[model samples]
Target: AEVPVNWCPELGTVLANEEVIDGKSERGGFPVYRRPMKQWMLKITAYADRLLEDLDMLDWPDNVKEMQRNWIGKSEGAEVDFQVADMPDAAIRVYTTRPDTLFGCTYVVLAPEHPLVASLTTPDQEAAVTAYVEAAASKSDLERTETKSKTGVPTGALAVNPVSGERVPIWVADYVLGGYGTGAIMAVPGHDVRDHEFALKYHLPIVQVIAAAGDDSWDIQQEAFTETADTVVVNSESDLVSLNGMSAPDAKEKITA
Candidate 1:
């Protein structure tokens, strides 16, 4: 919500997010920089549950109702904490549906517009991260996703995996939307298409943790095989817990339990 709006220094008017296009005002074509502004904000998340429950009362079509449900975004996932490296006191929290794949996570990606971007970027990586953040600020969520290339800049910061205690690099990518999920994600490149693409582009490791039935091809370089309830878990090795050889449903239940 902090993207730069069309503002006229001469007219002394502040426009809305919809009023600006291509870094210019729609009406005047005056140059506008995507800048952040301080303003009163509403706590809309407090009403999310209520809004989602009320959708059933609307006399709309099934598709329309489903669309509204998605808009509310009532996702169920564990909010795991990842401690930022070097910044002992700082951390980033991410919500993930597949907590069972924590071992497969090779890296973590944060939306360029994520609030923690500025604080997480190290001194050596500041200039590149700043420019990337600025470019992201100017792009709309849809425009950002339109680019086919899986582009991202490392934050020069690392995060400690909660389960494995392993260190992984943190990155800023336009693919991760600031408003979706938690504005951050544990990148399991082995089972996610988007994550696989990003990892391949950056030469990051890809570890397969889910074994598909009759599908011996666990090679991530070929394609990412999304696990479902029927797939069995594998390579989930950790002192805390292990889901190897367990069905996807069983693994999720055991891990979350």
Candidate 2:
């Protein structure tokens, strides 16, 4: 949000405040130098109502509308915090549409850019973690995007599963991004895409808690099992009720409740 100012010494006069030349003086044909200056700022909030009105009349494509809807992502769910066993003061939190999958989470992943990644890494793995984080940072915004390769380094820290009281290893991975619902994520390989890839790469366990549409083949599932209306929750604890023949939204609410 910073503006640039140009000053020309040979002109003997200051250029207009809005003047922006490419490596040239606006007056007297002399070289201009960039100078930092403070100026009053205009508030864009004054046009908020006008902008909203204009958007209502604009012709936007369905894809753009879908993207906007996804961006808004106003989903109702619980934000559960799982404590890190090694780091008592720290916790890994994840927002899930199906809190019923809470017991099935076998690992926890923190985005490589997460602030806690540095401190959570053990002394022995610090060097490797640092290198991974630096490499991830150096990647261009496009290269660092979600579509890029899945790279990660184990943090040597473990998070306590809130429901099962089991300690799950914490990993710093690029597959998880800081801009998502949370910088950290509960790895449910049986039901999530990124987690499935990470689990395959690391040979981690993939437990199936939700049955797919047609087949119940967990071992042969080529991709993550998506939750749908006909999907059923299986292998859940006694306190967690089964969601057989229930809609995904209803099942999620019932399990979380």
Candidate 3:
């Protein structure tokens, strides 16, 4: 059986050394690459704890360790269910570090490539949706990275705020991805980076739910403000008050409560 492989046109033969020439093609000076090949694979389920221990003992910088810890993302938060407007039985759920953002969620977004997008998109927007999806697919992986411009198509579907009972528009955007924590996200533009960009691009409402310490000089027009210190939940419809002297995590709980 001939197995699929990554073949560099410039390279004459199949690669034998997994690591060579700064991890480039050994032949013809082509850029060698690693592509998924259907082959016998070893399951590392038995090495989970051992691998974790090895990582803990590594002589790495604090920032690197912190990044690993963040990637592991072992934390506690509420799983809030948001009801989809117009579609009674359908809903999009998201997990957030700050449930305090629930009231600030001006819009909800699914990855442009999300499966639900097709079902949720209105008939009038079908053509536009198809075009946006095509454009998103044509973008290179680097171009689809988070730093790229926030592009989206209005699904014409709305998600009801579980707390406020307000209907927020659902948008299918390339900035959100199926591989992320959730394929869908409730966009609290006031607090999130990507959401802020999307709101600015679409001229959506951006309410500042949380405030910074000292002087409130953070400018949303010039840049995204994500400094999470001395945050106070402003314009909250609920009884949530200014989260003074509370860390972001604790503040989220108090506000949600």
Candidate 4:
């Protein structure tokens, strides 16, 4: 299968997860980076559900069972499509656990290696984009996934927010990995920590579309993002839908319907 691995040029070997630390091989302290390679592997994902279920019935230590559960890493979400501006046939697909927050989307991010990036980037940004992608090629997956002062370059293209029909800019960012999900993400900075930090660094707009129940005055400007039980949808609307005044669950169903 084609997948990313921690590859070290100095040792000419692929290191295991533990063998790579801070983007270097432990033995030689040689720099390693994620590279796609055809490797013999097992597709254990097919048994993930069964494996998780069996843990509950096993007479194992509580901590061990929990560890196994974490390893399975199941995430439930919907795939949303954001079409490239003026190019309906070309699109960016993203998987998100928060489909109900569609209205809050302020921008879209594509992994540096996503297939569509090259075609979508404008001529004016070609040089900058190429340089950024090259620099990102040598970073480990862990370093890229952590959004510490998230870094990205403009593609000089935009995508249309599916729900609001708003035109949002597209960027090729290091924090998003091509091997994960759809290699693209509809960034809802108002409710997501990674997205929020990226937005703050890039000076992107952050608009709140959900609020604490009965507190219409809640302000996202104060960094009030809590996945609390008491919450309601707010400021989410379009010609085809209005999630305003609805709960997150209800809004998800209505919008996805």
Candidate 5:
């Protein structure tokens, strides 16, 4: 929740990351910490899918329409409920656009504002989680969404990966907004950039479950396999569902079933 910023005391202004050339403000060469504040926003995300679907009807140029499509950022995925480990009554519901990679889930993330945050956090993490949630309170919805830096605190509790049967740690982060999707996400570090960043920072696991249709060049240590055009599942199999070697779409549908 505590975002980094280039705060320049000489200029008395918080400069943007790009504006700070070599740790100093570009204009005055003032020393700054890349941090600051800003505005309000409305929840227009509920209509993102509708907006993207109707984009073709617009008379705008292809480039502008493409931009609009990117802005909408609508993802088609499934909602999965990961039951809490050792806690029968608690579960965290997550919406993922890549359910086929369920076997690769290294951890789970919950929004700081999630209702189960306080209850799910173990006694050991109470102080740190409280500080994090309190710090996150200052962030606006827009800020939280746009924040690229990942910050989180472990709940000390784990979630049973529904498909893989792996006990993955649960974390609370501001980036996962309480109102977004299901306020939680199955963190598949091997397939998601943001999740990968967090995993690397925290020394968590990164398991690859997808690869190019015919290529086996993916290296989990380097980066996540985000391309799905002709990708197939790899290193993803369980007694309940064996998605290995299937195309992304087929694998998704099969797993979701």
Candidate 6:
């Protein structure tokens, strides 16, 4: 059956995402990337809610039912749109769970295969961006997930934050998967571990937006403070929006509303 298999161009074979390791073909150690050719999907995803409801009538263990529920993978988050700087008509959309940290976003990251990559890249960076994209095409989503080294190339383009109106640099990072939510993300270094690591490696600015009760003295350059429940917003005020001094939960409610 035709399926959306991980196609390894170098290996000349299609593989399941599980079959690839560290972005290479498991059999030949060649690079692999996702290619959506005509493929068969279970068609069961559409009935996930029905299956979840009917599981209650079955004689299955609670853990098994919970496992089934988890497998369905329903995620909740808000999709925020970022306008490309200098490209009045172009925008990059990203899904973020922490919309409250919008003020801290210092950079935007797109999957190497992101459709806007070509149009967004500046002429001076075209060669580098092209090379990075080609290299990243060889990496599987799992490889990108497993490798925490924070590899990326600057697209030489910028995106304007919708909330803060600040312009942030754009980078093409393999850690972002083309098939994932919007293939784009706002890099909030001070509140996200991965983003923090990436920012540190690249020397990008890390703005602290969430501060705990006693965290006013904490140095975010040393570490990212991600404790959501006990934190309050800080350094998040601007002409357009302001969540400064509000609790994290309250800020999220207001920003999302």
Please write out the lDDT profile of model 5 over residues 1-257, one tens digit for every residue: 33334456788765544575544567976655423244244667788878888999999999999999987887788889999998899999999887888999989999887889999899999999999987665555555667778889999999999988989999999888775578788999998898899999999999989888788977887897788788888988778879999998888899888
Ranking of all predicted structures according to lDDT, beginning with the best and ending with the worst = 4, 6, 5, 1, 2, 3
Residue 37 of model 6 has an lDDT of 64
In order, the Cα lDDT scores of the candidates are 0.80, 0.68, 0.68, 0.86, 0.82, 0.85
Window of ten residues with lowest summed lDDT in model 5: 32-41
User: What residue pairs clash in candidate 1, if any at all?
Assistant: none
lDDT of 2: 0.68
Top model number, TM-score: 4
Per-residue lDDT over 1-257 for candidate 1, one digit per residue giving the tens place of the 0 to 100 score: 45333354544566665766665566777755544555566777789998988888889999999998887777666887899988888888898988878888889999987889999899999999999988776665555677788789999999998777789999999878776667899999999998988888899888888877767666767788785856877888688888888887677788778
RMSD of 6: 3.1
Clashes of each: 0, 0, 1, 0, 9, 2
Instruction: Compose the digit string of candidate 6's lDDT tens values, residues 162-219.
Output: 8888899999998988766688999999989999999999999999999887668879
Q: Can you list the residue pairs that collide in candidate 3?
A: 25-32
- Writing each residue's lDDT as its tens digit, candidate 4 over 1-257 gives 77767789999988876787776888978988777788897778788899899888999999999998998898777999999998868999999988989999999999987889899999999999999987787677777776367899999999999889999999999888887778899998888877887888788889998788876665675563656477888889889789998889888888888
Judged by whole-model lDDT over C-alpha atoms, candidate 1 comes out at 0.80
Using TM-score, rank the candidates from best to worst: 4, 6, 1, 5, 3, 2
Model 3 — TM-score against the truth?
0.69
Model 2 steric clash total: 0
Candidate 3 C-alpha lDDT tens digits along 99-195: 8767778898887656678888999999999888766643323345534676788988888888667888988876665545566788888777777
* Clashing residue pairs, backbone N/CA/C < 3 A, model 4: none
Q: Which pairs clash (backbone N, Cα, C closer than 3 Å) in model 5?
A: 5-33, 5-34, 5-35, 6-33, 6-34, 6-35, 7-32, 7-33, 8-32
lDDT of 2 by residue, 1-257 (tens): 23323456677544552342343454445665434345555654465456545555769986775665554445556788989886778887887766868767989888776768887889999999988876554332234443445877888888888876778888987656665567778889888877788788888777777776566766624677765556666665543245554545666687667
